[model samples]
Target: MTFKVGDEVTLSTRAGSRAVVEYGPYGPNGDIYLVKLLEGDEQGEVFGALARVMSTPVFRQGDRVAGFGGTEYSIVAGPFTAHDTWYVVKDDKGQHHPHGDDRLTLVSRAPKPVGPTYELDGVTYDLGARYRDKDGDVWRFEVINGEPRGGMNGKDIYGYSETLAEVQQDYGPLIKL
Candidate 1:
């Protein structure tokens, strides 16, 4: 692929070496890139290298990234020359997929919800979560459309809570029925 100025690249012959593409192509050397080396003994040095010998890897190995389709992938290996600087990534199912740097975007990972699902007394609760009512009865709480609802048989319709803590506070062990 054609590279423009400010693109991060590495050389095919040198491992762990990085550079930044400076000037655009010019003349018979139109395929050659003018770059400032970012690492190695040649750090801070400016030189020209053939475009075919340069690789542009957008991220380091072991980064969690997402493609345009929103599929999450873990970068396993790469920036090696196999037609180009390709990154090997693994999916949730442990399947391996290859991608170029330009195809991915770094994204923040979402936190997994906690809870083991609870079933106590006659109440069945999802995620092992429960609250004690004023009558000393156990109730399960669920959030629906941003509203916290409570019930005894996994269907809370009698009591409503603005938050999970509110449900516990209003109907907890400390509260009297």
Candidate 2:
């Protein structure tokens, strides 16, 4: 439940991805930390979560899992997409199934994967191609990781997925369970 400032963690109860820990582990009100979400609708804003629900993801491709008396399975997928998404897992006998977000309790997450990334002022931003600085200026990138990166960099770093409903048509489909 303890966390350092740079730790990437998830929320056990609901949608969250490789969000960064911005502050706290404060006592007196149960250990809590403020996390800045890197994806989904809440990107760039700091929110709080009890330390109990925050932990380093320990699962990776090909890891083993088992229910109390259920069949053994292997993780055939990665972290949930858009925070609250599900995982696509496979069983020992070779069958892929989409498991609920809660099923992640059987396993944790591995380090956050690096997708499309760009840098400005030495700080690297991922997932989204556009970003706004503390000064509230908008900037755009024509390409990142060889793919078209779209979004608005004003007020906040809003990804194309957040700003546009036609994201799949332009950016391609997101990872599904």
Candidate 3:
């Protein structure tokens, strides 16, 4: 298979992640390729060094590669309740991390009612993402989409957002990259 740097490739198998190529090493013994894989992405690239080429390579940046078996993510769909597992409430008889695990953490933010989904540029994305409610709590909804900006992750799938009241007043939610 032909591949090159700056290529946008996905897993051929059930791979979860995608990446832009950074390096490829080849030699008389065999050919090797290096790719940057995102942690959240599950699909990974695969090819044995001993394999023989059967055709001309034509891979470029943003080309979709197939058949990669990558890691999967556990995206729980729910109104999740996170508790302080380590800190004990003295009067309520609630015990802190009695096992000394010290795994307690504070809630950064919680998500509100995530809305539906939308698509742009032939891509789909979640409606509500990185949401912050009236209480200053933040939450994230997994409206998945493709890697944009050539595999950069900061692009919000929903574009931009406004409050329900603002949206109603304006007749729609604000969408921008």
lDDT of each: 0.64, 0.56, 0.32
- Candidate 2 per-residue lDDT, tens place, 116-175, comes to 654434545454333343333233344533444444322232333233223334443333
Model 2 alpha-carbon drift over 4 Å, by segment: 64-73, 77-91, 94-165, 168-177
Better-scoring candidate (TM-score), 1 or 2: 1
Q: Give per-residue CA lDDT, model 1, range 1-177, as digits (tens).
A: 678999987677555356799886765958987888764345578888788888766666567899779999988787667665678888999999988777878775324335444344454445334554565444555656644566542233543434445555565542211
Error of 1 at 80 (Å): 2.5
Model 2, C-alpha of 17: deviation from truth (Å) = 3.8
Better of 1 and 3 by TM-score: 1
Which model, 1 or 2, shows the larger lDDT? 1
Q: In candidate 2, list every pair of residues with a backbone clash.
A: 57-109, 58-108, 58-109, 59-108
TM-score, predicted candidate 2 vs. hidden true structure: 0.41
Stretches of model 1 off by over 4 angstroms after superposition:
65-71, 100-177
Off by over 4 Å in 3: 25-30, 41-177
Model 1, CA-based lDDT: 0.64
